[model samples]
Target chain A: MAKQKEEKLHKIRKVTPGSVINYTLITLIALICLYPFLNVVAYSFSGYNAVLSNKVTFFPIDFTVSAYKEILGKASIWLSMRTTIIVTLVGTALSLTLTTVAAYVLSRPNLPGKRIMSTFMLFTMYVTGGMIPTFLVVKGVGLYDSLASLFLPVAVSVYNFIVMRTFIMGLPFDLEEAAKIDGASEMQILIKIIIPLSLPIIATIGLFYAVNYWNDYFNALIYIITPEKFTLQLRLRNLLFAGELNSAGANAEGIGTQVMTQSLKMATVVVSTVPILLVYPWLQKYFVKGVMAGSVKG
Target chain B: MKQTDDKNKAALRRTTWKQIRKCKWLYIMMIPVLAYFVVFRYAPIGGIVIAFKNYNVFKGIWASPWCGFATFQKIFANKNFWNAVRNTLTLNLLNLAVSFPITIIISLMLNEVLHLRFKKVTQSILYLPHFISWVVVAGIATNLFTQQGGTINNILNAMGHDSVPFLSDNGWWIFTYIICNVWKEVGWGTIIYLAALTGVDETLYEAAYLDGATKFQRLIYITLPSIKPVIVTMLILSISSMMSIGLDAPLLLGNSKVQDVSNVISTYTYQLGIQQAQYSESTAIGLFQSAINIIILLAADRIAKAMGEHGII
Candidate 1:
């Protein structure tokens, strides 16, 4: 295996025609994926005229920070940003707690009624309560139009629960038995030993929850009614599509006028997306592991 | 004999109770999770019955009168509902047709890329799109595909050609939609295949090379066959989900003009249920869609098993 791996490494320099084609195709696909983000940055930072005249492509023309300033200056944008941050933070915390506890309880192979409880959770994955009825329930429970409606209804994802459970299951089972023999309770084992050891899986699942909460516009669109409570994704949607300008400092010249700066529009995307991009390189491997574990067994 | 049987039953009950008592804390931990599933997951299922009722918002579900199959009938009679159903299938199939093979080809290409570092970087870039919100993707698409100021269109204009209406026209909208979908997920789709790729026997490749098999020939014979099961499983999985398209993509990417092609089942339900407040009818449509989905899923799983593979489900 080591010999083969080393040979594979050496083959990089011995580039055949097929390898050349492979490299070119891979690079092209990468560029296609990446160029849009570059364009987003270019449009977000370019001068107003440059954006208007379509001068920006992959690089900023007459680069300026006014679009970012304009967007950041607005009360609506900041409010939405605050709402998104709260959702991501609170949602991730709740999801991690719920998923961790459930995973621990389910990972106990000797636990009575494990099959029933696990099948109950797993069934939710195959068939869901479809959209409208779920909406009615949320509304019926008095979560309608409230900020709690954003995250509380989706407190735990079954897939993430399973992934976390799978991770916990893969740990040496004897450790828990040893703890039990030492007079440690199940809760004590989970709190004192399991959590500390399961930090990687915790972070992976936590990031999953965070990204879901941050990019969640559909939930906000359906559940949230108040303008001030709109999440960042929903707020960006309105700014991009509704042609509704701000009522504040961002548009001091013409308040409530439909004067949209394309640059500012693109800036919202950048602002919304930059966090994901920043952490993506780090997130890629963990995400890959989570998917592999969750999927292969499934 | 009767007394002994009763005593045995009593002993079983006591052991069961003891086991429960031992893991009592685990049971305590399960309360919130159990309540969440009961309230959020199963309640909505029970709520799906309102599709058969004359659902009144003020009257509530319990008070709503039964209308037999009237709500389902109303949805079935609507032309737009049929249109939405057709559009959903078209877009999903089109999306699968374009994306599935491209994903496999790219995975194969990625596998052949000799430079490990370059391959990793490429994969990283590809996976980036799967993380971004559809709102941002829609925003980026608009900025890049619009006729007037869209960068791609602008480039065309600069070359003295009329700009293409990528988003507005129906035919082009589907094409653009497929392109966007492929761009977003094609990279992430490779993860499973690449994992499968690593398990392929290296000796087969070495043997093929010793026999003077060309690179393309080796790829076709050795590389492709190795990952066929993953490919089939993934294909069946996608096919099973044909009835369901995410609400975000179509609802965001679509405009007034392209609604004919873009108005999918999920979006249609949203329009009727949430926007128009025709709650009962919307629920009926959802129920109908899910019924079809289950049938398709079962059929696909059977097909998988019939082909001498483990069922997808």
Candidate 2:
């Protein structure tokens, strides 16, 4: 009994220094990751004068929602927001459907040309024809300048396909065999039996697809030429790169100009990121799961 | 004997057709996918022929006059092209050297955490940055790194130090680029390593503990050796695509002040092909990048296989 207590005490002592160092480092990194976003939030909510005086830090200085108000009132922001919503919704649905169908088909053991089909998809992951050729193909297909251009050309990600396929392949063969014995067709089996069991993966992959579409600016930048058709990221990029975020009728005096512009830019950042941030916590657990699933095949 | 071989070939082909016919539903399901691959992927592959031609909108791809290495010659002659190549290589190498090991180290540290709640919370927060768009990352970076009354600069001035031109100076801009890249990705990169670490046997650790191995010794002996395969795989995968850098980071983080340091292959191709209408030269540059990528990928896969690691390919 004395020896047991002594060993326990020794184990506890050994853990202290390592745990302290690990916690300290992890906490510091977490703070570093969270600080920039917090800074943006603080700047966006700070009073114009406080921001102008460069006093905003971890907390908002002289808090106000006027920056968000001014931003929300803008027609261009609303237009871009609407465009982004449409693209994300449509893009996610299309990508999920195509990816699921492809993955399911490819996952079948007795499916003809399964190896060749898998290789066909996998080959693209390594050697893409670079940017311009893909651009030309998108143009040739009449998707240019449309919302379809944002998602259609890149609908079925090979990585996502592989991940989803791996998930499906792990399901017991007897489940499908039983369904097949009952005269359920492949489509019916997929919709009724396979999908019901695979909701976790579907939800996870759906979130992946949604995030990809939501955050994509490269597609919108390269394809969408019109200002009004810009997605949220593209619009945010324009606002940022243009460097003119001054409110139309607000105070245009002295240092207030830079402060207002900077605050407004920060507010735009807040606005653009809010959608992803809102859905983030709910989908976060699934993201870790998805990463694991993907990495197994990877 | 020749006739028998021919008969066997015909019989094999018939069986193949019969199997394909039996799996007609699967083939039907694959229609959209195959079309997507053909049009979006393989078609672009065929579009590489334009690199050899002076691509003209009116003449189209086939009607355009083939230039016979002229585009490659032009790209080689251009100083900006060389500069872009150098910058891409330097930035990628820097990223590989710094961010790669940091990812493994962070994962190891996280794995060592005694409290589950602390581990989960840190992971949640760390993964947050990866989901944020590059535009937002750039915007936030600008807010922090700008010389005039920027957050970092303001803090520096308050501490009696001169302001740093993080966005304006070429070298500092590269530093800022790396910081942003590492900051955005480091946590997310840990996920793969963490996943690999989970596969490590718990029994080994218990045995080590029983053998009077210190925590650090166990980590050095058992933990490090176990995760080495994953590390090697990830390293090879990264090394295989050394020439390819995503356009978003460089383009969004860059300004005219640091163009020399920031212009990577993707951004350079974008500017040349889209903005300047130098399509043939851009295509040629892209083709060159693709060729180098394939060579590296094959060589890396071969080396990995030769080293008795499972082939990544």
List the TM values for chain B, per candidate: 0.95, 0.95
Candidate 2 structure quality by residue, lDDT tens digits, A1-298? 6775576557656757668878898999999999999999999999989987888878899989999999999999999999999989998998889888988898888776898988999989877777888888899889999989998888889888989988888888898999899998889988998888877788889988998899999999889999999999998887776542212232211224343377898999999999999998988877777777878753
Interface RMSD for each of the candidates: 5.2, 4.9
On the 0 to 100 scale, the lDDT of residue A244 in model 1 is 19
Regions of candidate 1 where Cα sits further than 4 Å from its true position: A1-13, A243-258, B1-10
lDDT of 1 by residue, B14-118 (tens): 998999998899999999999999999899989998998999888989999999999887888999999999999999999998999999889888887756788
Provide TM-scores for the models. Answer: 0.94, 0.94
Encode model 2's per-residue lDDT on B1-313: one tens digit a residue: 9999999999999988998887888899899999999999999988988999989988889999999999999899999999999999999999989999899999999998767898899999999999999989998998898887789999999999999999888999989999999999999999999999999998788778778998889989999999888888898888878988999999888877678898899889999998777778898999999788889888988988898887776
Candidate 1 clash pair list: none
Q: Where in model 2 is the C-alpha error above 4 Å?
A: A1-15, A243-260, B1-16
The lDDT of model 1 is 0.86
Please state the error at residue A165 of candidate 1 in Å.
1.5
The residue-by-residue lDDT of candidate 1 on A172-290, one tens digit each, is 87888889899998889999889988887887888789889999999999999889899999989887767311121232112244358888888888888888777767766677777
